[model samples]
Target: MRDTTADGAADTTADETADRAGLRGDCENCFGLCCVALPFARSADFAIDKPAGKACPNLGEDHRCGIHARLRQKGFTGCTVYDCFGAGQKVSQLTFGGRDRRTASREDARRMTDVFPVVRQLHELLWYLTEALTLPAARPIHGDLGRALETTEALTRLDPDDLAALDVPAHRQNVNVLLLKTSELARAGIGGRKKERRGADLMGARLKGADLRGANLRGAYLIAADLTGADLRGADLIGADLRDTDLTDADLTDALFLTQPQLNAARGSTGTRLPESVTRPVHWTPRL
Candidate 1:
């Protein structure tokens, strides 16, 4: 693609940076694919309404953003922060054969779009696990990380048809055990693995550095625990009341169902890592 922007030199420089670091969601190679494929509602986050697999009005047929420079003014701040962790490009080029889902057969398009999010999720796990493998603090799980990387890579390489059939959540559950151990080893230097607020009714415990790895926190009423520094690496929070647990520094990165609001509410510093699909919570504002 020719440089259409004013500073053609700047575009080439950016292309070099992107190629070296692996493509981020903002890369031009993506063809603004996510904007067109995903659904959104008319609200504070989205200025206009859109449905799944439908093209966004601001998307140009040339795979460019019509409101690229003024997305914030247009109420697309959500799109600004969205990242596919390299999965978007992979789906566009590899899984879907370098073509947009909209151009594919209806059945193929539906299947591809529906499965993209799921694979994006798995790739997300891969991203986190790959990062975790690099942490010296997680040395105890280095071997496991290597193995996990291989397994997740194998899964990522599967054909979209086969990938769509996968039970990812179940696979995630199996992977969680190893991730739990990595968390445990990393946090052990801070404290032992046990967090007990037994009957304290910690609706939202903020124990980011309070190590709870390997702790049997079963059935604990931590509906919304603010476990910021608390380490829950391998702690069995199974059946625990974590409906809205704040896991900012809690290191539930490898823990189970620690999904969404539960993952978003907690305080965490930059060192506090998590899955790719999920991002660091913007609210906590930790400096650590």
Candidate 2:
């Protein structure tokens, strides 16, 4: 629920306040955890290969990105797309008590680094759960979503050892079931039956200008696919691989479970319609 203002500042909107959301990254309150804890190989998205626990050269002592203004220009496009869902600050301030890995004891540092990714997964689930609760079509399962949200929230507060020991994949599978149900209910409200493409391997498929209203695209491999001008209103895109997907002029006004990361990895034009939850990536222009 954290959106960028016209000036690119993380501003809280009225909807965010109404939901009491904590899903936006608050870098000011974090210890630059992602810059150091996450690993990256030299790829189209990253400039260099960095192992886990190694700090990026552009990370400043103040825990701010030194190349924030030119990340894409400097071949660090992945950094711009990454969102910790407020996990960085929660792990920094609450779990580690503001102690950064740089200055902490070796054991604490290792644990902090390990616990970050675990907490991040929980926070991501919280983001989805919070969104699910907002859908009126999912009203029948609102109680379950609220309980899942509470459980995920509590998991994020666990000690580093407990968090690191968690079977996250198992938890994710359980949450996915509920999310799939939510998707069904939401799309059902869109009227006619939807295309059943859930878990389909549609990599590089040509789907330009297709009528995909109420489609089930969960876990679809849409990498490098042409989705230009597609009518994706009310489609379920959770876990969809959207890397390099062309979304130019596509209508995703009411797309379900679409995240900022997915949009960041895709190409879009000024004509692309998006939901209120996410901001269009800066590089998405007509020329792309």
Candidate 3:
């Protein structure tokens, strides 16, 4: 999301710029992999149940969402918040050499489907590692993060069979170590007693206007919580569930590890102050 340092200044380093570009989804170059590879059940998110490896009814012949512009309005809110982290295009153009799934053999298509999720996971790690490298406070472990980013990027370029057989969870476990260190280093400079709410269940809690500066909210269940106007500056938010969380006017400047999908899933307002890495959610109400 952000290619800036912890101080909110943009990092224009060549590596940083390239990483930022590759980390975002470019649907035009993708072959609708997510619409077919992933399955969804009918819920508040989707209007129909779709099995894995089966194309969604809304997938077009040209490999685009038929209702791309109105996914949330059409009861496919899940799609709007779903980000493949640029895995879709990488799989379509590089892994399979731009082969169209419809025209490919059944076995090839199956392999494509099976390999997608693995690469997606790796790409997400790349995203985090890239962000970590940009943090000035995490300079102590920049070498480790750089190596991890290189290794993870190499893995993404592996053959489909190799990608499918890769031990992704093991790799993710290793990457988490560096990310944890980065979080600690970045939050250390924040002036205040930071709250430690890691993995805490704060679902639906009335925390409006709470002073949570430098809080470690990693993996915290914040679903439906009223966090309006909360001071979450410099807080670690990796793995925090923000679904339906009210972030209206919340100041999340310098928040660590907050992803776009997490922000998109929450309810915010135009008055919400966010980090440079993430944009204001289009669905957020405009301030009067």
Candidate with top TM-score is 3
Kindly give the stretch of ten consecutive residues in candidate 2 with the minimal lDDT sum: 5-14
Q: lDDT values of the candidates?
A: 0.60, 0.86, 0.89
Model 3 TM-score on a 0 to 1 scale: 0.94
Which wins on TM-score, candidate 2 or candidate 3?
A: 3
Candidate 2, residues 1-288, lDDT tens digits: the string is 333344433332327534534677889999899998999999999999999988898999999999999999999999988889889999999999988887789999989879999998888898788788777788777767776777788889898899989999999999988998999899987877689998899999999999999999988999999999999999999889998899999999989989888999988989899998888888898644
Misplaced by over 4 Å in model 1 are: 1-20, 191-288
Using lDDT as the yardstick, the better of models 2 and 3 is 3
Question: Which portions of model 2 miss their true places by more than 4 Å?
Answer: 1-20, 286-288
Clashing pairs in 2: none
Off by over 4 Å in 3: 1-15
Report the Cα lDDT for residue 114, model 2: 93
Name the candidate, 1 or 3, with the larger lDDT value: 3
Question: How good is model 1 by TM-score?
Answer: 0.61
The model with the greatest lDDT is 3
Point out the higher-scoring one by TM-score: 1 or 2. 2
Model 1 agreement with the true structure over 1-288: per-residue lDDT tens digits: 112233211122224232324324535666565776678888765788888777788988887888978886889765654566676777777777776655777887776666677767776676556545544566555666666656776887788789888899988877777666665564455445355433456675555467666565645777566666676654544336654455544565544323333344334567666644355655455655
